[model samples]
Target: MAVIYLVPPVSYTCPNNTTCCDDPTFDTSVFKRTIATEFHLICDKSWLQSFFQTLFQSGVMAGSLMFGIASDRYGRRPAVIVAVMLELCTGIIAAFMTGYWSFTFVRMITGAATGGIMVVTFVLLMEFIGTDKRSMFSAIFHVPFAMGHMSLPLFAYFYRDYVQFQFAISVANVIVLIYICLLPESPRWLLAMNKVNEVVTILTKVAIINKMPTDTIRQAVEQYHINYHVSSIPKGSVADLFRTSNLRRNIVVMSFTWFACSFSFFGMAQYVSYLTGDIFLNVFASGAVCFCACLVAIPMLTFMKRKKAVAICNATCGVCLLIIAFIPDGILGMVFACLGMLLNFLVFIIIYLYCTEMFPTVVRNAALGFSSMMARVGSMIAPFVVALKPHGQWCAPVLFGVLPLISAVLCLMLPETKDIRLMTTLEEGEAIGQSSRKIGTK
Candidate 1:
């Protein structure tokens, strides 16, 4: 949501054919500065706008790291409440803020909350379900994000008024706040926190909901002695990520993948809105194509081998970007744009699944959270990068095209893990990598 707000505003080109007061406005810039400077609401200073926009990503990265630590130490529910409250407060202020700097500050704060929510949400949802169901749920998670991404342009188009859009975003958060209140605490979090009693209670409720026998769950918990203190579950500092050779490898791969994925995803998402003709039609078409590509990837991965699926997705994305880089701005360019847009969706699902499988339970969320932060870093730079390219120039496409090729090379370094248990421990992941099996042989 924060990305949805910040990027487009910074990219806003003033309407009166004038350059931004703070920076040069490229010919292809979408948001007109005349409207921003004239209206004095949505934007004020160009550099400030860009600064606030990029700050959201940096803040989210820092905030999510803190949230991950807090969730591990305290519990998922409490950390989530902190995030929620922050959301409600910052969101309201952003909606009603009259000054540019004031609202931008609120955006940064709200971005932090958004990041925390994302890290916690994915971890909690996976914990709530059985292991076998995790992949399915993880894939399903992207649908809402895809919907939200698509919805942004639609709302921005219809509202045409900045304050109105902010109000709508705030109203949506109110719904989320109420929704979160009704959800129960994650039992896995309870177990990790050593609150055996609470874990049992939550597990029992979950068993009842699923119409499963609670006795089996209770027996398993007792057998595992979940209440056993794990003093080694130390402060999951980011540095802990490099303690082992295998973990260090996982971190490097995921970090690179995350950055590449974000660059491709947002670079195209925001750029599509700036396409030369029919802004609404172009944005809608691009978003819809990407969403469809995501849907197609789910089944392909389910039936195809994991390594093949990912490798193919990367190759497809690279090829599409390359095509887009060279295509002239006309009918053929439109076709390549649509294809490149779909590849964003494809890359998203592949990277998302791959990242989740790379780490063990001990640091799964932390690794994923940190990787997500890096991805946002890519998103932060995307708007500025696009701003540098001349209108009708293919420079941005060439650059976007190159990142995926590099990502494809990195993808080659990861071991395939299809038809295998999800890695939750450092030792377990390393063993799989060393296993005597075909890389994609199941």
Candidate 2:
């Protein structure tokens, strides 16, 4: 949302020319100083807006890979701290940057950190949650993201200046830092890492919080600790994800799902630009709608298996969007488009849960990291997809409608994760839903 807001599409106007200026000026009534305005990135240099986005997304792609490994290698808590610190530092630096080259550089690094925070924090959350309550927690997890999306425009509306807005958002990381500090290390990660003492401490703390029996917690931890050491789960690698047929299929299918979700979700948001509403209000409303979708998803999670949810949402969203391309721009058209948008958001939430439960604990973050990197790739392509507006009005919607349907078909090929335990070893992951054939086996 900040990315779109950073280049205000409506705030500037032509002062003298009857038709919008040949060499457009960024002079508004309030003198809005966006990156577009400050850099005079109007007519010819307009592609720079997409370029800036690409650079940031490229950073996110790299960061997801790097941090995913880092968390697996170092620890989730440490990796999160490092990622957050880098994000804070680069964001602050970007606010002060005057040179376009320098500012974009900072944005890239900041994006990397942001990506790290995103993938790592999610893995951490899923690892902490038990499967029975996973749906509620995962759905609730997206609330802050939607709220931030809703809040960015509010910040942009009041701050108006790029510098002030940049700095203000940078400071929001302080809250993340505090939250990280207060979190207990994931007992799942700890157990897999053979840090049973730490796991015991974390569970003991949890027992204290829930007012459970500490002795029971400690003895249970001891039994698990002894079993863990006896049948220790070996660490995992990205290569391992591809070696086993089941795990390999899961990752490949998930990668496409992630790509489609990112591509379509952002495409849906940007596609709103073609609509007749106020862009700023549209942005806020879009966020609000997504938040409501998250809330509504709570009940849907009760009955919908992960695979079924994704398939249903994707198919329905695709049909609604296809309908949107034909209809006149009216309340009915808007309703269909909004429904597509809402379903895309639900796919995102469900897919996260799907991904978390499919992979084993050892390589879970790595799998998510790779999927997120693909998601970044999808998002990078989204603007260009939206830019297809010049070719045909139907180009964007048709593609949007088609991609999710393809993903819906792919969703069926995936094994169900609803009743399956979160895998702790490569063997466990490979064993999941083995009702499907194992091709390319050695």
Q: What TM-score against the true fold does each predicted structure earn?
A: 0.85, 0.92
Q: What is candidate 2's CA lDDT for residue 151?
A: 91
lDDT of 2 by residue, 213-276 (tens): 8887767867866754524777777888899788898999999998888888887787775566
Specify the poorest-scoring 10-residue window by lDDT in model 2: 433-442
Show pairs that collide, candidate 2: none
Angstrom error at residue 311, model 1: 2.3
On residues 1-442, what C-alpha lDDT tens digit does candidate 1 reach at each position?
3344334533445556464443334332444322244333233444454565677777677767778767766777778888988988888788777776677678778888888988888777766655456556667777777677678767766564567677676667777788787777866555544556777788888789989888777677765443334323344556667877766876887788778878776777666655567666666677678668767876765776655666676677777777766766666766776787676667677666666666655666777678888888887887676665555467777777778778777777777765454443455645555663632211
What TM-score, to 2 decimals, does candidate 1 have? 0.85
Candidate 1: residue 286 Cα off by (Å): 2.8
Candidate 2 stretches with Cα past 4 Å from truth are 10-23, 27-31, 226-231, 329-333, 436-442
Q: Please report, in order, the local distance difference test score of every candidate based on alpha carbons.
A: 0.67, 0.81
Worst 10 residues of 1 by lDDT: 33-42
Counted clashes in each candidate structure: 11, 0
